[model samples]
Target: MDMTLLSRLSDFEWRIEAHGKMRVPAILYASEELIRDMDNKVYEQIVNVATLPGIQKAAYAMPDAHWGYGFPIGGVAAFDPQEGGVVSAGGVGFDISCGVRTLLTALKVADVTTVQQPLADALYRHIPAGVGSTGRLNLDDQQLDEMLLNGAQWALKLGYGREADLDRTEERGCMAGARPEAVSEFAKKRQHREMGTLGSGNHYLEVQHVVQIYDEASARAFGLAPDDIVVSIHCGSRGLGHQIGTDFLREMVLQAPQYGIELPDRELACAPIESPLGETYLGAMRAAINCALANRQIITHLVRQAFAEVIPEADLSVLYDVSHNTCKVEEHMVDGHLKRVFIHRKGATRAFGPGHPAIPEALRAIGQPVLIGGTMGTASYILVGTDESERRSFSSSCHGAGRQMSRHQATKRWRGRQLIDELAGRGIIIRSPSSRGVAEEAPGAYKDVTSVVEAAEKAGLSRRVARLEPLICIKG
Candidate 1:
């Protein structure tokens, strides 16, 4: 992160040139100020990622880059299977398919403000949250398998959500290639009661109002307007995802030597793309992605129930849903030839530009919606993918205001009770199961989201569409 050590390519691009076993250079997109604030570990992890087999173009760190397990949290890299590429467990992260989904409500800020506290209470009562929270749905083994395979489509079939919601979701709400048989029984048991639950640790459900529109066209496409109310759900695959990551990461470490893959760090353990273990991990990982999609769908239903109790005529419709942590098989141009590659985005969102077939047809002309979540009580933003992004970083962008400190460090710095009271004074309502959980996610513990989004736009990764200011937050 130090200026003296980096090779500056431009105001928004910095490079760590290939050296030693590195197959490609490490490129980071961020402003000088953000770069200086970043942990030195991010530089080391990205450089380590570059050393992996069959890495393409470069190992990239987005504007919100931070130190993570193996690759930096905001890292992006693509690997070609035909070129001996490998799949890394650390790259996809533990909370598989952890993402943000915003829903458009017919109500406005004025309608919510009048009944804010009671509405917040209703939401907290209806939506299960916090560590080890269990939802109303208790799945049997058969139902669990079905949900794992069907995802949001399963939820819709079960009357949790409408048919139209699937069209606005990534991969149409169910990632292909999910192998329920590959998922361990232990992982399945862990998630049997987690559906519709919001697990703890930075995960939340917030009610927000559209405060600004930067791109008129995209804003209209996303159904945004000044004072319009929206509910955003930020969560993931919960226990199943964690168990899958834990199981495979341990297995990959043991299998790495057999595959002749040298890991710079044990945490970066991986298997060759063609290997059986790699295929198995991918199967399990995709299932977890489906689990998350289904989980969010169920929660969306619960959110509707809560809103109906507070405001009888409220209509909550899906805007878009996207995942951040994933390793997706996609095609990209390399050396003027199209190449099929596995793109691993850790704490990074897929920013498919306009006309990308993966995006929903209704919004194809504008591009994929890239939701950037801010810390508690801060403003979040909705940005659109751009064609320039496809060329620059394999169509990836930052996920959020990357953590500035660890949860332990944050808890030591601020008391939850005081933080809650402070936000309450600012007209923000905070509802949570534990005051301690609140302390660990204090707003000061993250980088400035506005600055991060600005750097992302300046680097041409995504174009801003609108800004959202939080009215109430229900923390897990």
Candidate 2:
């Protein structure tokens, strides 16, 4: 954040020149004020990422960047396998494939307001949430393997979600090359009951209404309009993903020396892309990605069930689903050469441009939908990917309003009960099993989302489409 440490490339871009063991420069996208407010650790982590083997172009931090395990929470980097590219567990974080999905509804703001509390209550009761929460559907070993192998496709075949929903999902609801055999039995055991549950910490199901439209064409393509009611679910692969990350991080750390990988930091532990450990890690990681997709698919069914009970006429349909915290194999142009590489996005969202074949055909004309969730009391934005972003940060954008303070710091500043009462006063209803969880995610605990989104747009990471304000929030 210190101006003295960076060379300004533009108002939104800053560069840290390559030095020491760094393989490339470090690039950051943020407004001056946001950069100043960002934790100094973000710079440290990003620079560390630049030092990793096989990293392409430069390591990048988004406007909402913050301190994280190894790669900054909003970091983006691509690695070339042919160049000995390594995949770091820290780069993908613990919550594998954690992401946001927004659902469109025929109901308007007025309709949701008529039964707001009851709807919130219904969602809370039906959708399992909070720490260690388990859902009605439990998977056995065979089913677990099937779920990991097929992802949301498995859910669809079981009639959990519509066939149309998969079209808008990243990787079409399944990351390819998932190997259930690669995942540990312990990881599978941890996930046996966690499916369809929204785990604790920064996960929630919110009912929102579009408050503003920035691009009419993009909005229309995304099936969004002012005053239109929508539901956004934020979560990931629960215990399964956490266990995989834990297992891999430790293995990478202990085995790094054997692979001739020197540690600038132990937390940045990684394995060469073509190595046995790396291949095994990728297989397991892809399974976790499927786990996350399957979990969201099942949760979507529960949400629709809730809606049917409360307002059957409300046509809730899939908008788009995208994940953060992933290392995906993608082809991108580097030095004017089209090459396939692994792109690591930690707390960053994929923002593929218009006409990208990877995106759903229905919305490809506009671009991939980038869902940005805000705190319980603030506004969330919906944006579309831009062509410029593909050339900039490997088509990556900020995931959310990054934390301005730690959970402990936030709890010190506000009480859960008081915060709930205050939000209720503003016509926002919140339901959570743990009041302390609400305190941890207090609005003031995060950077201003509007400012972060503005910086992203200005930096050509993505283009704003619509803004959404919460009507109800079911937190974990």
lDDT, residue 330, model 1: 97
Show where candidate 2 strays beyond 4 Å: none
How many clashing pairs does model 2 include?
A: 0
Each model's lDDT comes to 0.94, 0.94
| TM-scores of all predicted structures | 0.99, 0.99
**Local error of candidate 1 at 122, Å?**
1.0
Candidate 1: misplaced stretches above 4 Å?
Answer: none
| Model 1 lDDT, residue 202, Cα | 84
Cα lDDT over the full model 1? 0.94
Clashing pairs in 2: none
